[model samples]
Every structure is written in C-alpha cells, then in structure tokens.
Target: MLLRRRRFPILQHLGVFSNPRSFLLHPLHSPQYSSSKRNREQLLNSMRDLKTVDAALDFFNKMVAMNPFPSVKDFNCLCSIVVKMKHYTTAISLIKRMHSLGVKIDSWTLNIVVNCLCRLKRTVFGLSILGLMFKIGLEPTVVTINTIVNGLCVEGNVEQALGLAERIENMGYESDSYTHGAIINGLCKVGDTSVAIGYLRKVEKRGCKLNVVAYSAIMDGLCKDGLVPEALGLWSEMTGKGIQPTLVTYNCLIKGLCDFGRWQDAAILLGMMMKKGIMPDVQTFSAIVDNFCKEGMITRAESVIGFMVRMGVEPNDFTYNAMINAHCLQNQMKEAMDVLDMMVRKGCLPCTVTYTSLIHGWCKIKNMNKAMSLLCEMINKGLSPNICTWNALIGGLCKVWKPLAAKELIFTMQKHGQLPNLRTYAIILDGLFKCNFYSEAISLFRALEQMNLDRHILIYSIVLDGMCSFGKLNDARELFSCLPAKGLKINVYTYTIMIKGLCKEGLLDDAEDLLMNMEENGCPPNACTYNVLVQGLLRIYDILRSAKYLQLMKGKGFSADATTTELLISSFSGIKGENAFQEFLQKLVGV
Candidate 1:
C-alpha cells in the first residue's frame, strides 16, 4: 500500500480529504478533521443566530485551522461577517492573513475595511490602508474616498479632509451630494461660514440636490454668527428652491430671530412653519416660548405652551426651564413653582437647569432658606449640582449676610470636586469683606495668591477697600505696591480706593502723591478721588490746602456736594470764631 501510494501522489492528497467522511462511516483516518468540520459547521450555525460580536469571534477561532487555504469568497464572507459584528481587530487580522495567502482583496473588501476603521474611530488607520491600496494598485471607488472624507470631518481635521475631497476630484472620482454636505457641515462647525456658503453655492451650481440637513447647517452657522436676517433670507430661498424645510431648519431660524430679539419676526416665522403643515416639533415651540419669556411677554409665553399642548407636542424640561427663568426674572416665584409642579406631573424629570432656575428665583426674593431646601431636594433626587448652582447659593447667602454659611458651602463644593471659578471666589471675597471678616478675607486672599491665579484689579480693590475701612492704611498701601509686581495695572477704582485709604488716615501728603501717581499712570482721577483729597485736608484745619484742592476739583469738572462744603465749614470754624468761617464759606461757595 505504501508503494502504491508513493506511485500516485494525487491519491495521497485525496486520501487526506477522503478520511474525514470515511471516519464517520468506518473509523479509519484521523478524527481532527471530523471534529474541526463539526466545530466549523456549528460555528456557521451559531453565526446565523449571532446577537453580538464576541460570540461570533469566539466561533471564528474554532474553525480557523480547519480551512488550510480559504477561498476568496470564503474570506470575503468572513470579512463581511466580522465587519458587521464590528470585530475590527479580528477583521483586520483576517484581511492581512487573506492577503498573505494570495486571496485577492477586491474593491468591496477594501471599502469594508475603510468603513470599519471609520466606525471604530480609527480613521488614521483607515487612511494608511487607503495608501496601501494605492501602493498595491487597487482602484479606489468614490464611496471609499467619501468614507475617508467623512471620517476626517468627524475627527475635526476638516481642512485635510477637504484637500482629500479635492484630490478625489483631481483623480476623476465623481462628487456626490453626501460628500458636499459633509464638507459644508464640517466647515460650518469650524465657524468658516463664508467658505461653507461658497461650497453650498458650488454644490447648487453642480445641480446636486440640497437636503434639509445641509440647509439647516448653513442656517445654524448664520444664526450663530448673528446674521439673523441673512439666515431668514436663506430660509426663504430654501423654501423657494422646492426643498421643504424640516423641523430642525425652522427651529434654527426661529432661534436665530429670537436671539436677536426679533420676537415679532420669530412669531411670524413660527406661524408660517405651522401653516406649511410641517408639524412643529417641541424645539420649535420651545424657541418661541423662550423668545417670549426673554421679552417679558409672559402671557404670550403661556399661550405658546398651551398651543404646544394643543398641537400634541409635550413640553419638555427645556420649555419649563425657560418659563421658570422668565418668572424668576420677574420675581414671580409662585408662578415658577407652579410650572415646576406641572413639569413633574407631566412625567418630565427635572434636570439641574430646572432646579437652578428655581433656586435662582428664590435667591432673587432673598429667600436663601427656600433656595437651600431646593438644593437639598436636588441632591435627594440624585442630580449633581453644577458650578452655577453653587454660585447662586453662595451669592444668595452672601446677600443675606450669611458669609460663614457661604464659606461652608464652598468647602462642601470642594469636597464634591467642584472648584470655585473666579466669579465665585470674587463673590465670596467681597462678601467676607462686607461682613468685616478681614482676617478670614486676608487668608482667602493669601490662599488665592498661592494658587497663582492671575491677580485681577477687582480683587486688589476689594482688599484695599477692606483694609482702608478697618483703618489699616499702611497695609492697604503695601497691597497697592505689590499689585504692579503681580502685573495688575491699577484702574480708576484702584486709585480711588487708595486715595480714600490715605485720606482716612490723615496722610494728606501721601494721598496727594497717590493722586499724582494715578495721573502719571494714566488712570485719570474721577470725582470720588478728588472728593476724598478735599475732605481729608479740610478735616485737620488745613484751610488753604483744602481750598486749593476744591479749586482743583472744580477745574476738573467735579462739583462739590454738601459733604465737601460741610467739611470746609468745619475746618474754617476751628480757625477762631465765625468770621473766618463765614469768609471761607463765601469764598468756597463763591458768594
């Protein structure tokens, strides 16, 4: 038998193939083939009912060794199944193996790989594959290049994607409407509306049909750029072009008009959208309602809600938040609460914005207790309070002279991983200073100093005002000296605070020096600065100096009020009897 098998080498190869079936019948050959074939058949059966990629991958490995050389069709089937399953790594491995085994990867297979990479957000790998395809002389179809362009746009490399689009055109690949739309949308996202409009016109000249999505993108860009009139014109042009506007298109235009305070025009557009039988979506009604709320047209805003419900569109959380914020602005907390109850009853779960609006409303009424309760309720409902929520609470507490409570709340925010922004810090600092917690205020200032946040002129002024109010004039002057080192140029407020500080300490010479320095620094002294200097000199019976400052104040176009005259009269009264006082009053008042 060995001699006969040696003589027929073809039969030797056939012998290996024939054993698998014969083993099922007579048990003569190796059982590996029969078991592998069984597993492969089982894998194929499982693939038909495959619900997830992992299960399909688990099955693919069992049958991999069974096929010594899978046909191109078989490899293609595997590639298609793996791609559909999103088994990208395995799919790529299969493609590479097929190439090594001389299985031709056709254009369809290449496109599938590109698409798979795009879906996986591995567009760079997809582009590398495209380069490989070119190196191997595989012709790229238009769909393949479009996939690349779309992927690039999604990755925010739109400029390079546009270059690729141009290259596609240079390669004689026909451009499609989808490609134009992708480029237009990408350009609009990057705020390059001019180029986006040019592309839109190019696509229009090419007779490629413009869809609602494309028109909506351009309208949104125009709206964001504050070109509301131009956006409305384009809306009309879109309708005139025989392309019906989608709900998104109407929402964009209505929102644009509303943002620009063109409520009358926005209302007309809303009615027109309704008249056109394009059943207005929730966003459309929300936009109009928000516009009405912004204009303080509460009755019109309520009518919009009623119209929305009548039209079978349920008002969402955003709609309720808008009404609540509007009522809050008007200090109508009861109405805002009523809207909140309505929102809850409608089964629309309130978001942080909903709670934030209500909290702000209570804060507006100086009802910090109610705002705190709502904050606790927000936490109980499992909503994480954002920075705005904390800011409102802190600011409200500060307004009510609860600076200690505000500080505790800030610590709570820090423990919860919410860092106080600059505005929050400023509010707290100002609150502490107003409450006469100077030590604590200075500690906060020092802490901020260590953190190296840029020193703002407002912070410096607030600290200086606090120190000056507490009769710490030298400390206030030292703080001023350090301001320039910290790169903060003194503003008018800064100079005014320093002048008041020096004047309050009876340091008229130092006050005058600061006033001169203020002018030298180009921070022109306002009425307050001059008023401080005139009053300071007058306080110590320095009538000549006081009168000189008054004359300078008048020259600077600052009128002396009763306080100025009273200070001058008191100074003159100290100069022995009422004669000098009367003369000083006459000279001072020009009588």
Candidate 2:
C-alpha cells in the first residue's frame, strides 16, 4: 500500500481533481455553484427546443424559481411567445407579473403588447397600458405611437388619434413616414379630406417623404366622396412628383368615373393606365363592366369580359354577377344562364344574387315554375335564397293573379325567418283588392296597421277602394279618418276613393264636404271625382247640386260625354216637360 501511494503520478491526481463530482466535493466548489450550473444547462436546453408558449412558460417558471430574478430579454421573449400564440389576455397577465417581479420591460416589448391589444380590438386597454408604461418611467417609441394612431384611425376615431399624434410630436419624437401615413389615412377614412390634404401639405412642409400608399389613400377618399376632379388633380400631382399610381389607385379612379356615369372617360383612363405600365386589376375591370351593363350596352360589357380574359385577368363573382344582372334586365335568359354555366366551369361559385337574377328574369316572362325550379336548385347548391328572391317570386305570382300562391310564398318566407317588406305587403294587398277578395284585403290592411306599416297613404287608398267596391263605405270612412293621425297627408288617390265611396252611397252632403276638403288640402279633383258625384246626385234626384257639380266640371275643362247627357235626361223622366228642369237638361245635352 505504501509503495502504490508513492507510485501515483501527479497527472492522475490532476485528472481526479478535475472531475465534476470531485470538484463538487472540493472546498472550491460551493453548493450554489453546482445549482447554478444545473440551472444554466436547463435554461440552455429550454431555449434550444422551444416551440410553444406553454413550454416557454414552464422554462420561465423554472428560471425564476432557480434565480428569483429574470433579465429584460428573458421577460420579453416570454411575452413575445405569448403574443405569437394570440394569448393576449395571458400576455397582459405576464406583463403585470413581470412588472410585479421588478423585471424591466423595454419599449419594443411594450409596443408588442400594445399592438396585440389593438389588433384584438382592445384599444382602451392598450391606452391604459400606455399610461401604465408612462407611470413606470417607460417612454413609447415612435413605432408604438404609430400603432396606436393607426388602430384608432382604422376605427374612424381620427380626431383622438391625431391628438395623440400631436402629443407624440410634443414629446420630441420625430414622426416617421408611417406615423404621417396613418394620420392621413385616418382623416381620409372619416371624410375629412380637407384636413387630410392639409396634413399632407404639413408633411411636405416638414420635409418628410410621401409614399404612394398615403397618396392613394387620399385619392381613394376623394373619389369615394364624389370629388372626382379633385382626385384626378391629385393623381396628376402624384405622377408629377415621381410617384406612380398603383393598381389600387387606378381602381379607385375607374370606379369613381363609373359611378359618375363617365364610362367613356373611364375607358380612356384604363388606356392611359395601360400605356403608363399600370395594369388594371379585377376591380378596375369590374367597374368598367358594371358601367357598360348599367348603360344597357350588353355588347360592350361582353367585349370588356373578353378583353379581361385575354389580359389573363379572371373575372370575380361580382363581375359575373353584374353581367348576369344585365342579361336578365335585357330578358336574355339563355345568355344569362350561359354566363352562369361559364362561372361554374371556372370553379367560381354562384351566389344567391345570381340565382335571384335568374328568378327575376323567369318571373318577367310569367314563368313561375321555372323561377321556382331555379330557386330550388339554388337551395340544393347550398346558396340560401334572400328576401329579394322571395319577393320576385311572390310579385310574379301576384302579377299572374295567383294570390293564394303568393300567400303560400309569404308563409314560406316567414318560416325562413324573413319578414315581408312594406312593398311586399302592398303588392299582396293590391292583388287581393283586384281579385275581389275584399275581406282579405281589409284584413291585410288592418294587419299592416297592427305591424305599424300602414302609415303609407297608398296602402290606405288601396284598402279604401276595396271597401268602396265591396260596399263597406263605413270601413272606408274609418280608414280615411286614421290617415291624419298617422301623419299621412291624403293624396289625390285617397280623396278620389273616398269621394267615390260617398257618392256611391248617395251621401251627397258628406261627399261635397270631402270635395271641399280635397281642394283645401291642395288636391284638385280630377274628372273621375266630378263624374262619379254627378251620377250619384242624379240617381238621388238632387238636380240642383248635380247641375252645380256639372257646371264646376265644365269650368275645370271637363266636357261631359254622351253618357252624362243620357243620364241627365233619364233622371228628368217624370219631369221632362217641366220648363226649368227641361231647359237645364237641354243645356246639358247641347254641351
């Protein structure tokens, strides 16, 4: 044993001493040193294979447990992982936790959270976070301010965002291109084009560079608000300033020109865009196509579609739908269906409006079965029919005097959670009246009143006419009385219906009062009112009032027809030889 101890080499002793276990046992290596080494290894491994927020959070928990303190970089990485996962609430919670633990957060980390909050539509909470950052002696960078301003601007709160931008400038932070662009975009979005232009001038005065996006935003806003000339001037200014128009810029101008009915000018602009190496986009083609269709130039519209396909620009659903509507309007059903088939072949799905247009076309031809079949096909294709489609079907049914079918269609609409509009109710009511379904007509009229939709005087007149025809003059009078309380001034049709109802009932006194009221309300009676009244008075043997009305009718440039002369002569049958009555009758017949 003594010989072995003497024979051990110093190299072996150094090797034994360099082992980690031996170092731990040595006085030079404390327990803290071993623990720190273990923690560092774990932290390195965590950073190497990190993928999700949960793993990052677990690693962060272990790190804080090991050291009881985290660096700013460690806290930022954890928060970034949370933001990347869109766990905004959890990210905010981590920020609060990091603050409580006295971990310093940088401006970049604050901006990340602020942007996440704004993207989540939690801008109020984001502003509070900004205030908290200020309270903790942290300054928001220009980028952070720009994010807040852009969020507010997109939300149409440009004034508040501008105030915040001014505050950022007052804090000695230089506004970058993004900052100015956001403010200009916000102002323009809210229709404050004048302010937006002034701000643009200020940006130029301040020597900040203006990009194409900012100019395009202004141009889009100007065009949207019908300031086409101003927008065109700005476009010229932009080109002169060496900024080329983008696809969006040309699209805005094309759409604006189309909206203002300047189709020829829009075409010229399209040619100019092509010559200037600016390609027209789908929106541009759609605008031109829609304009041609609106002008009833179907040939021109089809030519535009061909031109788009040749240019390698495929039409979108809106483009196809517009052409289909044009074809339907022209009653070219076969062409419309062919376009729909083409749409399907191109892998483009037809929307409800496509089917609705086809249905309307079929309805126009009184082909309700074809319309119904197309509607069923739409439903089977998973395109739900809208109110317009149902309206077309119902209106077509009513047009063909199929009121029962129209009522059935109304029930179907209600089952699908679509209530008929006032127009729908009006058509149904008019149909019922024309079909002599007076009871149903009056019931529908009262139903409209119950639904608070009877304020329209036209609806009242329809019901009154039905009542007069059905000899429900009292009901007509009651409905007429309710019109004024509903704030509906009686129109010419209302007075005519009511006066005719009273005349038919032989109520001459009441009819004359209504006639005076008609004139008082500035609705001068037409020939129909005078003729009906004269016939009523003659039937009741009131020759004096009848002669007065006949004279008034003549004064109003109404010549009594042969029927009127015959009626007057017949009314004086018993008293035909009397002198005064005979003279009056003779004068009326001569006229």
Number of the top TM-score candidate: 1
Per-model TM against the reference: 0.66, 0.64
- What is the C-alpha lDDT profile of model 1 across 1-591, one tens digit per residue? 222122222212222222122212232232223346566556555556756756554444444444454345555666678777766655665555444334556777777778877877777777876776676677888788889888888877889888888887887888787888888888988899889999899888888897878888999999999998888888889889888888888889888988889878877877887798877888888988998998899999999899889989999988998999999989999999999899999998999998998898898789998999998999899898999999999989988988878988988988778898888888888889998888999999999888875378887888889899988888987888998888888898889888888888888898899899888888888888888788887777777777787777777787777787777556655665768656765765653
User: Against the unseen true structure, what C-alpha lDDT does each candidate score?
Assistant: 0.78, 0.79
User: What lDDT score goes with residue 189 in model 1?
Assistant: 89
Error of 1 at 170 (Å): 3.1
Residue pairs with backbone overlap in model 2: none
Model 2: per-residue Cα lDDT over 1-591, one tens digit each: 232233223212223212133322233221222246666666745664677766765665555554545566766776677677776655655654454445655677777778877877756656766775676567887778888888888888888888887886897888888888888988988889889999999889988988888998899899889999999999999999998888888898889999889988888989988998988878999999998988889899899899999999999999999999999898999999999999999988999999999999988888898999998898898888888998899888887888768978898888878888877887788888887777787787777779789878878888888888889898789878988888998887788788889888888889989988888889888888788778778878888888888878877888666666778768777675687867875675563
Error of 1 at 13 (Å): 35
Q: Runs in model 2 with CA error above 4 Å?
A: 1-105, 158-160, 166-177, 183-215, 233-243, 377-384, 456-485, 489-591
lDDT, candidate 2, at 304 = 88
